[model samples]
Target: MWRNVRRPWTAGRLYEETLEAAMASRPVDAEARLSSPPRASILLDAEVQPMGPLAPAEDIRTDPATWDPRLERAYYDGDLRAGEAVLELYSRGVDVSRIQRAFSVGAFGLSRLRRMVPTRWSITAVDDIISARLRERIKTYDWIPEHRVYSLEAMGNRWVVLMSPGVWTYESIEAWYPGTTWNPTEDVAFVGDWEGPLGRVGYAGMGGCYYAARLAVTEALERERRQARVLVLREIHRDQLMPLGVWLVRESVRAALRGRPARFDTLEEALEEAGRHLDLPLRFWLRVSETLGGGRQETLSRYL
Candidate 1:
């Protein structure tokens, strides 16, 4: 009777279970604040379960906008690969989030080869795929004429995107303040990863944030048809109490890039401007940043 009643959890169920577990296990007052219920009834960490058979929305089923030509072509083609399909769909103006959702459901690929992917894996994979395609094209474009710094602050997180005239290289560093979600100790925690002109080989130590920020910067460069060495510095303050998703990094970076940048004639000047908005010192950023090394000026001056 027990065996008959039991059933294997689907991938979506497993994912939700894992996420809830992580949230519940976090040792932070902020987590408590996040899950705290208000006077008015509101959904918090709630899952919706349909009581009867589920059906697609009429707009989604009948609307012509729901039909993605690129995805349709890739879905039916036996020869079209997933990566190529993603790039084509992206080039044709499909939303990144939409692509990620479709890819997670195995919507783009040969019919026989299709399979579901975990949501987190799908998000990271799509970011990496799109960024890689953009990187190749960006490398062929001319270098940015000057050093540029873009900054934005959201949800107690500060982002500084610094781009300097050079061949294609990228780096992302996150400084977690003391008492923050990831850093409960008195000391701040710093984690970073970098890649050269040829790009990285294995997974970045910084994980999804690395890929997300990379995608944002590459998209900016591709739009300008320019190349540059980019360094993304994110500082998560104590007020940022809990962990939000990597979308924070991606969307914040995109917003920062859209704003007018503080331009400079040299990398050193750009670093100086970027450091003004950050809690950390310029020397510290230079210490951890491979893209903006302590001797970055000396290295670039040789080529200049």
Candidate 2:
């Protein structure tokens, strides 16, 4: 009746009217995503970034921020940055995982190079070494397996591998947590993990080997600091993730919880148990966080 009222409204007219009415009725400021939760990117281990120095502040080392980008790019690709300083020096170009300044490569990278040099290995031969010789070293040494701590080392050093076989293999990394929408193009480097890369890193990247690596290094360092059974610090031949590795101290507590312990149920209990096993200073660092930097470990006992 209304369509025919004024002079027979056509179907097109009605459609136009309907659209206009609908658009007019809508709010000007209506948010399309009113229900979305606000999220932000943050580092899991901010305090984990080391401060001061292994020796004095003056003796402090290189800056990571200024590290050569080419090397970083290579590392982001699927290449393992192994071998001696010259050979294994990671670069962003192609398949090289360059070491950031200050974060030394230590023994792992060095030994890999030493092996490669003597063997004059082809790429296939080198790949075989990763599983055979490297894997063998991992089996025999406590250091190779990874730990709760890592030690700094000088180049051209001879060191025995140290690390135990790891349990709780990191079967997979589900996602690159949080930010995924942003484009990584144009001089963009986020201390962020891309889902694909992280998955690759995640696959065989479990908490146990990490725990072993950092723990052994820290134990040795603590001993050195206290001048009690000082273990000689070894050079990191590739980019060492020791400081980053300590974040898993919390995971250690979790790993400990998996089994039935004689003493307790909570991770706190396991931590306390582990603490008692370590000396006072080392235990102190363990408590504050997974570990402490050289400066933090020395808390100015006698006021200057």
Candidate 3:
């Protein structure tokens, strides 16, 4: 006889349910999961700017004494359940930078099995959660009126954002240099898993960089109160010698969005405009781009 085994929920579903619960009421279950004694408040009620620089991980680790006792206890008890509670605090206006630091020190997840998550992992987790929440809002908005191409360069990384007037879709393409973090020898490229209007089925294989870029682009669309089919191309040059963490990807994309993009009448025109600024040829980027390359003939058919 075979016993039935229930399948676990996807991270996205868990995130949505957790967020819904947090918005509706205090997360009592999250609190119950905590192993440590409860405190009056896990996060203090303080006003903080929405976006700010991330503190170095070393700084957070070296000064664990400064961490909030209540939040620390919550993490020790509930693990990811505690993280949900922290997200609730964030919704109530606590500083994100502070919450990120707390997570870095192993203060957000399971208490009994608590261990410091690498800074990169912590950062990405936060980005994914926050962006997932943001996506819920942006999906209700209108689409852009025209195609637009935005580009920027920082720390030897070049970023190009191609926005198509359509339902919300996002894809990120990363081209790693020979000596860069993921590619230590010959140049290589990878496309993050695509997400349609309804959202992604699984985590992006490229990891944190994908979430960071998604968050940045989502913020731009939200600001305009308009959605789009967004394709982000990131090219890493040998000059970037070392891994600067996902923060670089987040900030650089954010910076590009802040600037005015060159407008175009069509996707091909936008790609042509974006190509002028990239280190690699437009053909190379399109070849590796799932959104643009594989589907190009079909996409161009309507125009032709």
The candidate scoring highest on TM-score is 1
Can you write out model 1's per-residue Cα lDDT over 108-215, one digit (the tens) per residue? 666556666656777889999999999999999999999999999999999999998889999899999998867778987899999998999999988888999999
True-vs-predicted CA distance for residue 58, candidate 3, Å: 16
User: Between prediction 1 and prediction 2, which has the larger TM-score?
Assistant: 1
List the lowest-lDDT window of 10 residues for candidate 1.
1-10
Q: Whose lDDT is greatest here?
A: 1
lDDT, each prediction: 0.74, 0.26, 0.66
Ordered from best to worst TM-score, the candidate numbers read 1, 3, 2
Ranking by lDDT: 1, 3, 2
For residues 1-304, what per-residue lDDT tens digits would candidate 2 score against the true structure?
A: 1233122123344333322222221212221222234344333331133343122111112112232343433333333434322234321122211121111212123222312111112222222222222222332333222222112212221121211123211111111112222222432111211111011234223222232333333333233231111111112222333233222332332233233323333334333443443222333232323112224335422221
Give me the displacement of residue 303 in model 3, in angstroms: 14
lDDT of 1 at 21: 31
Using lDDT as the yardstick, the better of models 2 and 3 is: 3
Candidate 1 vs candidate 3, lDDT winner: 1
Worst 10 residues of 3 by lDDT: 55-64
Candidate 3 regions exceeding 4 Å error are 1-80, 92-97, 109-116, 298-304
Report the Cα lDDT for candidate 3.
Answer: 0.66
